[model samples]
Target: MKYIKIKRVMDFIFSLILLIVISPIMLCAAVAIKCGGQGPVLFKQERPGKDGVIFTIYKFRTMRLETEKDGHPLSDMERMTRVGMMLRKLSIDELPQLLNILRGNMSFIGPRPLLIQYLERYTPEQMRRHDVTPGISGWAQINGRNGIDWETRFEYDLWYVKNISFLTDLKIFLGTLAVILGTRGVNQSKSQTMEEFGVATKSLKG
Candidate 1:
């Protein structure tokens, strides 16, 4: 209990410091997005937080709002602009999420919050991931991130949830830095991001 409180405090303080430190980069990213195309500078989406609570997560817009001939949206890679791709590759697109951390919707280290629509799709074991506040980066992120399968990702999330500690968070933070520097695990195979989970299956045992 005390550790959780301390973690939250650290998360808040570090996030505030980071926001201030990266404000310039964020501004540059916003300008770059505007120059790239016409769309909102920030991409807001609802994601599930601790205990299945919903919250608005913020990220820099890294894809152009493009449509198909029939007016449907194009695929992520297709809609991704040159500047957007650079932002994603450098992880500049995620800088805005520090605001989410400041707002208490996220933490510096925990499981990455997933789409809200995926709430109902989680198996009982997978549901355990929501036991703690979501994070900017976590064990799964450092281990394989989008490079791993969904089941493996959830397994790592659950593991972190069950064994959260200051040391664990520190490791994840350092690992995230390495990943950003190395530019690995930014996207999944053959896709800019991992594909969405359609429906929960009985065979999905987390």
Candidate 2:
């Protein structure tokens, strides 16, 4: 329990420092988005946080405003702008989440927050990932990110929940740097992002 408190302090202090250090990069990203003719510089979405609490997660907008193109709905890749793609590739899009970290809505490491719709879909075991604050990068992220299947990803998240500690977080942080530099697992093998959890089947588990 003390480490949890320590982790929150670390999240707050480091996120504050990182935000200040990265302000210029965030500004450049914002300008690029605006110049790209996108509707907004930032994308805001509701995500389930710790204990399934609802909170807004922020990222640099990475897709076009229009849902449809030339009479058909646009795929995520189709909607992605050149600048947006660059931002995503460099992981610049996630810098704004430092604010979420500062606000105590998230941590630097834990289970990545997921869509609000997913709150009801998780198995009781899977829902334990929400016992800690959501994070920008976590055990699942360093393991495989969007590249892995939902079951595997949830397994990693639960592992982190059970073994969260300074060393665990440090390992994830180091691995994240490698992942970003390598740009592996940023997207699914065949999709811009992974498919929605439990979408193909009626339930995750019988």
* Runs off by more than 4 Å, candidate 1: 70-73, 199-202
* Per-prediction tally of clashes: 0, 0
Worst 10 residues of 2 by lDDT: 197-206
The deviation in Å at residue 70 for candidate 2 is 2.9
- Global lDDT for candidate 2? 0.89
Which pairs, if any, clash in model 1? none
Residue-level lDDT of model 2, residues 90-175, one tens digit each, is 89999999999999999999999988888778889999999999899999998887888888889999999999999999999999
Model 1 collision count: 0
Using lDDT, give the best candidate's number.
2
Which pairs clash inside model 2? none
> lDDT per residue, candidate 1, 122-191, as tens digits?
8888999999999988999999877887888888999998999888888888999999888888887554
